[model samples]
Target chain A: MFEGYTLAELGSIFAMQGFAGLILFSVFVLMALGLAIIFGQMGVINMAHGEFMILGAYITYFTSNFFLNYLPALFSVYFFVAMILAFVGAGALGMLVEWGMIRHLYRRPLDTLLATWGLSLMLQQFYRSVFGAREVGVELPQWLIGSLPVTDVIEVPINGLFVMALTLLITVAVAVLMYRSRWGKQVRAVMQNRVMAGAVGIDTEKVDRYTFGIGCGIAGVAGSAFTMVGSTGPTSGQLYIVDTFLVVVFGGAQSLLGTIASAFVISQAQSTMEFFLSGSMAKVLTLLAVVGILMLRPQGLFVLKVRR
Target chain B: MRSGNIFLKRNEVVFVVILSALLLVVFPMALDSFRLNLVGKYLTYAFVALGLVLCWGNAGILSLGQGIFFGLGGYGMAMFLKLEASSPEHTAIQSTPGIPDFMDWNQITELPAFWLPFHSLTLTIVAILVVPAVFAWIIGVAMFKRRVGGVYFAIITQAIAAILTILIVGQQGYTGGINGITDLRTLKGWDIRTDFAKEVLYFVNVALLLGCLLLAQFVRRSKYGRILVAIRDKEDRVRFSGYDVSNFKIFIFCFASVLAAIGGAMFTLQVGFMSPSFVGIVPSIEMVIYCAVGGRLSLFGAVYGTLFVNYAKTIFSESFPELWLFAMGALFIGVVMAFPNGLAGLWQAYAQPWFDRIGQRGAPRPISPAPISPTAAPAERRT
Candidate 1:
C-alpha cells in the first residue's frame, strides 16, 4: 500500500491520517464513555445512547442559532453555553428514561436492548419531525475555524484540535468523577451489590437515576463536540450506535481505561486504513478485526476481577 | 380426552384446525390476489418470527442478526433467478451478454467464481438452507462455547448484521449494491410474474410456513424443548446436570437460522427481489418486534403477530406515515414493559379463564377426569 510514496510523503501521510483518526477517536470516546458507564456499571444496554448524543447535538444547534439571533456579540462563545445546555437536556431525559423505562427492566438485560431500540426509533422520528430530516451543521466561531499549516503536507484543522482538547478534558473529569468522588464510591457500591448497598443505607434508586443521567449528560456533551467535525442528521445516531457499542464492549465494559484504549485503537485503524482502502472497506476490516478479537476474548480487553 | 402421543392436546387440536383453516381457506376466499399476496409476504416474516419463538423465547438466544440468514437465503435464490433471467440472448445488447446487468455495467465480462454454484436451481436451494445454518453454527459455537450471551450475543449479532449490510451494499458490482437483485422474470421457465404464479406462490409460502410451524412445535414439545426452557432459566444448573448446554444452544440457533433462510427464499419468490435493506440492523430488529408483538413463546401468536404488525405498518405508513414509527415504537415499549409475553399472554390472562369457567359450567361433572392446575393448564392447552 505504501509502495509509491517517498519516505517523507509516507511520514506526512501517516501524520495527517493519524490526526484525522484522533478526531474520530475523540467522538468514539465521548460516545463510548457514557455507554461503558451505563452498560458496564449498571449492566443495562442503552441502545438509545446514540440518540441521547444527538439530543446534545440538536441542543448545540439550537444554542448556536439562539446566540446568533439574540446575542450576536456573544455568538463566538455560544459553543460553551451550548455544551452545558446539551448536558442538562440530555441528562434530564436520561433520568426520565431510567425512572420510567429502564428501572422496570433491571432484571431483564436483553429486553432493555429492545426497549431502548424502540426508544431510539422514536427519538429519531422526533428529531426528524422537529428539526426536519436534512443534515444540520452548527456554525463555528471564527477562532475555531481554519487550519494550522504544520508543514507543506500536513495541515491540522483548529476545530478538530478543539474537539480533541474537549474530549481529553471530559475524559479526565469522568475518570475523576467515577474513581475519586464520594458519589462515585456510592455508585460503584450500588453496582457491586445492590442489596448490600441498600443495607448500608445507600439509596440505590437515586444513585441509578443520577448515574444514568450523568452518563447521558456526557453523551450530550459528545454530541455537542460532534457538530465541530461533521453534519448531524436524524439518522446519524443509528450509524454510530454499532461502532460505539463495539468500542465499549471491546474495551471490557467495566473499565473506563479500556473504553478509551479500544476507541483509540479502532478509530486509528479505521482512519489509517481509509487512506489505503475505500472507506466502507476500511470500516468492514476494522469491525471484522474487532469482532474476531472479541470472539477470542469475550470478556473484552480488560476484565474486572470481582466475585459473584 | 387426552391424545396418547401428546402431539396435540384437545384444545390444541381445535387451535390448529382453526389456524389452518384461516390461513388456507378463509384468507384465500376473502382477499383479492394482491391483498392475498401481501398476506403471503407477511407470512414469509412469520417464518422468522417462528424461529425467534424457538431460538430467543425458548432457548433464550436472542440473535438480532436473523436478517443475515434471511439475506443469504434470498440472495442465494435471487442469484439463481438473476442468472436465469440474464441469459445470453436476453442481454445481447450489453457488453457482456451472459452476466448480470450490474456486473456488465461494472465492466466485468464474466461471472465471479462464487456466482458459479448459484447457476443451478438445486444448488441454489441447497445454498440457501446450508449457508445460513453454517454461518449460525459458527457464530453460536464461537459465542456460546465461551458462555457469552444475553445482551452481548444480541449486540454481536447486531454488529454482524451491520457488517453484512455494508458488505452487500459496498460490493455493488457483484451483489447488485443498494438497488439489489431485480427484474427477476421466471423460475425454471414458469413465468413467476404472472397472477396465477403469484397465487400458487402464496399457497406454496403458506404450506412451507405451516410445515415450519409444525417442526417448531415438535421442538418445543420434545424433551430437548424442556431442556431448552431449563437452560434459559438457569444455564449453569443445566450444564452441571450433565448437559452440553452450548450444544443445545448451537442446535437451536442453527435451527432458527434455517427457518429464517426458508422465509428469505420464499420472500424472494413472492416479493421478486432481494436487497441489503432487508439484511441490515433496522429490519432485523423489526423482525424481532414482530415476534415480540405476537408473543415470543407461542408459535401461533408469532404468525398472528407478524400479520398484525405488518398489517398495521402497511396501513399506518400508507395513511399517516409519520405516525407509523410512533405506533411501532410504542408497540415495542408497550410490548416489553406492559406485556412481556405479548398478545398470547393477554389472551391467556384475560380470556382463557373465562372460557374455562364457561366450559366447566357446561360440563355436568366438575372436571373429574383431571384436576387441571391453573398455571400449567393454559400452556399445555395452547400448543
Candidate 2:
C-alpha cells in the first residue's frame, strides 16, 4: 500500500495521522472520564452521558452566539466562559437526573442502563425540538483557527492543539480533584462502602449527587471541546456513547489513568487505520478488536482488585 | 390434579387460545390486506420480544445485540431472494448479467464466496437458523463463561451490534451497505409483492410465532427454566449447587438469538426487503423496549406488548411526530420505574383478580393442585 510513497512522505503521513489521533484521543478522554466516575465509582450506567455532553455542546453554541452578538470584543475569550457555563449547566442537570432517576436505580444497575437510555432519547428529542434537527457548529475565534507549520509536510491545526491542551488541563484537574480534594475522598469512600461511609458520617448521598454532577460537568466540557473538531447535533452524542463506554470499560472502569491510556490507544488505532481502510471499516475493526480484547480480559486493561 | 397438557396451566391454555384467535382469525378477518401485512411486520418483532422474555427476563441476560441475529437472518433470506431476483434476464442491461444489482453497481462481475451457499434455498433456510445461534453461542460463551453479566454484557452486546452495522454499511458490495438489500421481488417463483402473497406470508408468520411462543412457554415451564430464574436471582448459589450456570445462560442466549433470527427471516419475507437501519443500535434497543412494555417475563405479554407499542408508535409518529419520542421515552421510564412488570404485571395485579372472581362463579379453580408446596408456588410460577 505504501510502495509509491517516499520514506519522508510516509513519516509525515504517520505524523499527521498521529496528531489527528491525538485530537480523537482528547475527545475520548474527555468523554470517558465522566463515564468512569459515574459507571465506575457509582455503578450507574448513564446512557444519557453522551446526551449530557451534547447538552453542553448546545450550551456552548448558545454561549458563542450570545458572545458574538452582545460582546464581540470579548469573543476571543468566550470559549473559556462558554466552557464554565457548559460545565455548570450540564452538572446541574446531572444532579437533577441523579436525584430523580439514578438514585432509585443504584440497586439495579441494568435498569439504570435502560432508564438512562430512555432519558437519552428524551434528551435527544429535547435537543431536536430546541436546536432544530440540523447540526450546529460553533464559530472559532481568529486565535483558535489556522494551522502551525511544524515542518514542510506536517502542519498541525491550532484548534486540535488547543483542544488537546484543554483535555490535558481538565484531565489533570479531574485527577487532582479525585485524589487531593476532600470531596474526592468522600466520593471514593462512598463508592467503597456505602454503609461504612454513612456510618462514618460521610454524607454518602451528598457525595453521590456531587460525584454524578462533576462527571456530567466533564461531559459538558467534552462537548465544548468537541465543537472545535466537529459539528454538534442531537444524535451526534449517540455516535460517541458506544465508543466512550468501550473506552471506559476497556480502561477498567475505576481507573482514571487507565481511561486516558485506553483512549489514546483506541483513538490512535482508529485514526491510523482510517488512513489504510474506509472510515466505517476502520471503526468496525477498532470496535471488533476492543470487543475481542474485552471478552478475553473482561476486567479491562487496568484492574483494581476489590472484593464483591 | 396435573393439567391435561403438561406444558401449559389451564388459564394459560385459554390465554393461548385467545391469543391465537386474535392473530389467526380476528386480525385477518378485521383488517385490510395492507394493514394485516403491517401487523405481520410488527409480529416479526414479537419473535425478538419472546426471545428477550426468556434470556433477559427469565435467565437475567440482557443482550442489546438481538438486532445482529435479526439482521443476519434477514440478510440470509435476502441473499437468496436477491439471487433469485437477479437472474441473468432480470439484469441483462447491467455490466454483470447474473449477480445482484448492487454487486454489478459496485463493478463486481462474479459472486463472492459467502454469497454462493445462499443460492440454494435449503442452505439459506439452514443458514438463517444456524448462523445466529452460532454467533450467539460465541458471544454467550465469551461473556457468560467469564462471569460478565449485567451492564458489561449489555455494553459488549451493544458494541457488537454497532460493529455489525458498521461492517454491513462498509462492505456495500457484499452486504448491500446502508440502503441494504432491496428490490426483492419473489420467493421461489412466488411473487411476494402481491396482496395474496402477503396474506399467505402473514398466516405463515403467525403460525411460526405461535410455534415459537409455545416453545418459549415450554422452556419457561421446565426444570431448566426454574434453574434459569434461580441463576438470575442468585447466580453463585446456583453455580455452587452443581449447576453449570454459564451453560444455562448460553442455552437461553442461543435460544433467544435463534428466535430473533427466525423473526428476521420472516421480516424479510413479509417486508420485501431488509436494511441496516433495522440492524443497528436504535432498533436493537427499541426491540428491548417492546419486550419490556409487554411484561418481559410473560411470553404472551411480549407479543401483545410488541403489537401495542408498535401500534402506538405508528399512530403517534404519523399524527404528532415530535410527541412520539417523548411518549416512547416516558414509556421506557414509566415501565422501568413505576411498573417494572409491564402490561402483563398490570393485568395480573389489577384485572386478573376480577376476571378470576367471575371465572370462579362459572367454573372450577384454574390452577393445578400445589405441586411444590403452596409457599414456594408463587416463586416457582412467577414466569
Candidate 3:
C-alpha cells in the first residue's frame, strides 16, 4: 500500500491519519465515559445513551443558531456558552430518565436495554419531528476554521486540534473528579458496596443519581465538541452508539482509563485500515477484531481488582 | 411435575386448531394474494418469535442478533434463486453470462467457488438450515463456554449483526450489496412471482412455521426444557447439580438461530428478495419486539404478535409515516413496562379466568409452563 509514496510522504500520511484517529478517540472517550459509568456501576444498559448525546448536540445547535441570529459580535465565543447549556440540558434529562424509567428497571439489566431502546426510539422520533430529517451542520467560528500546515504534505485542521484539546481537558477533569474528589470517593464507595456505603451514612441513592447525571453531562460536552467536525442528525447518534459501546466493553466497562485506552486503540486501528480499505470494510474488520478479542477475554482489556 | 408437563392439553389443542384455521383457511379465503403474501412474510418472523419463546422466554437467553441467522438463511435461498435466474441463456448479453449480475458489474469474469453449491436444490435447502446453525454453534460455543450471558451476550450478538450488515453492504459484488440479492425470478423452475405460486408459498411458509412451533413445543415440554428453565432461574445451582449449563444455553441459542434461518429462507421464497435491511441491528431488535408483543412465552401468541405488529407497521408507516415511530416506540415501552408477558399474559390474567370460571372448572387446567408467571424478577420495580 505504501510502495508508491516516498518515505517522507508515507510518514506524513501516517501522521495525518493518526491525527484523525486521535480526534475519533476523543469522540469515543467522551461518548463511552458516561456509558461505562452507567453500565458498569448500575449494571443498567442504557440504550438511549446515544440519544442523550444527540440531545446535547441539538442543544448546541440551537445555541449556535441563537448566537448567529442575535449576537453577531459574540459569535466567536458562543461555543463556550453552548457547551455549558448542552451539559446542563443533557444532564437534567439524564437525571429525569434515571428518576423515571431507569429507576424502575435496575434489577433487570436486560429489561433496561429494551426499555431504553424504547426510550431511544421515542427520542429519535422526537428529534426527527422537531428538527427536520436533514442533517444540520454548525457554522464554525472563523477562528476555529482553517488548517495549519506543519509541512508541504501534512496539514492539520484547526477544528480537529481544538476538539482534541477540549477532549484532553475534559478527560483530565473527569479523571481528577473520579479519583481525587471526595464526592468521587462516595460514588465509588456506593458502587463497590451499596449496603456498606449506606451503612456509612452516605446517601447512596443520591450518589447514584448524581453519578449518572455527571456521566451523561460528560456525554453532552462530547456532543458539544462534536459539532466542530461532524454534522448532527436525529440518527447520527445511532451510528456511533455501537462503536461507543464497543469501546466501553472492550476497555473494561468499569475502568475509565480502560475506556480511553480502548477508544484510542480502536480509533487508531480503524483510521489506519480505512486508509487502505474502503471505509465500510475497515469498520467491519475493526469491529470483528474487537468482538473476537472480547469473546476471548470477556472481562475486557482492564479488570479492576475488585472482589466481586 | 410430570402431570403438568404435557404438551398442548385438550383445550390448548383447540387453541392451536383455531389458530391454524385462521392462518390456513380464513386468511386465504378473505385476503387477496398480495395481502396474503405480506402475511406470509410476517409469519416468517413468527418462526423467529416462536424460537424466542423457547430460548428467551423459557430459557432466558436473549440474543439480539437473531437477524444474522435470519439473513444467513435468506441469503442462502437468495443465492440459489439468483444463480438460477442468471443462467447463460438469461444473461447472454452480459460479459459474464452465467454468474450473478452484481459479480459481472464488479468485473469478476468467473463465479466464486462459494456460489457453486447453491446450484443444487438439495444443497440450497441444506445450506438454508446448516449455515445459520453452524454460525450459531460457533457463537454459542465461544460465548457460552466462557460463561458469558445476559447483557454481554446480547451486546456481542448485536455487534455480530452489525459486522455482518456492514460486510454485506460493503462487499456488494459478493453479497449483492445494500440493494441485496434482488431480481429473484423462480424456485426450481416454478415462477414464485406468480399469484398461484405466491399462495402455494404462503401455505408452505405456514406449514414450516407450524412445524417449527411443534419443534419448539417439544423442546419446551421435555426434560431438557425443564433443565433450561432451571438454568435460567438458578444457573449456578444447576451447574452445582452436575448439569452442563453452557451446553443447554448453547443448544437453545443455536436452536433459535436455526429457527430464525428457516424463517429467513421462507421469507426469500415469499417476498422474492433478500436485503441487508432485514439483517441489520434495527430489524433484528424489531424482531425481538415481535416476540415481546406476542407474550414471549406463548408459541401461538408469537405468530399473532408478529402478524399484528407488522400489519400495524405497514398500515401506519404507509398512511402516517411520522406517527409510526412514535407508535412503535410506545409499543416497545408499553410491552416491556405494562405487559412483560405480552398479549398472552393479558389473556392469562383476564380472559383465561373468565373461560375457566365459565366451563373449565371440571376440565383439567389448560396451560403451558410459560404463560403463568415464574419466580423471576418482575419487569419493573422502584427502589
Error of 1 at B187 (Å): 0.5
TM-score of chain A of 3: 0.98
Query: What TM-score does candidate 1 reach?
Result: 0.97
Please compute and give the TM-score of the first chain of candidate 2 against the native first chain.
0.99
- Model 1 lDDT tens row, B172-257: 89999999999999999999888889999999999899888988888888899989988987887899999999999999999999
- Weakest lDDT window of 10 consecutive positions for candidate 2 chain B: B374-383
Cα displacement (angstroms), candidate 2, residue A301, comes to: 0.4
Q: Cα lDDT of all candidates, in order?
A: 0.92, 0.92, 0.88
Instruction: Rate residue A262 of model 1 by lDDT.
Output: 98
TM-score of 3: 0.96
For candidate 3, write residues B1-383 as lDDT tens digits: 34653766655667778888999999999999989999999999998898888888888888999999999999999999999999999999999799999999989898889999999999999999888888999999999999999889999999999999999999988998999999999888899999999999999998888888877887887889889878877788899999999999888988999999999999999999999999989998999999999888778778889999999999998899999888998898888878888888887777876876666555587544334433133442312
TM-score of chain A, every prediction, order shown:
0.99, 0.99, 0.98
Which run of 10 residues does model 3 chain B get worst, by summed lDDT? B374-383
Which docking category, incorrect, acceptable, medium or high, applies to candidate 1?
A: medium
Q: Candidate 1: what's its TM-score on chain B?
A: 0.95
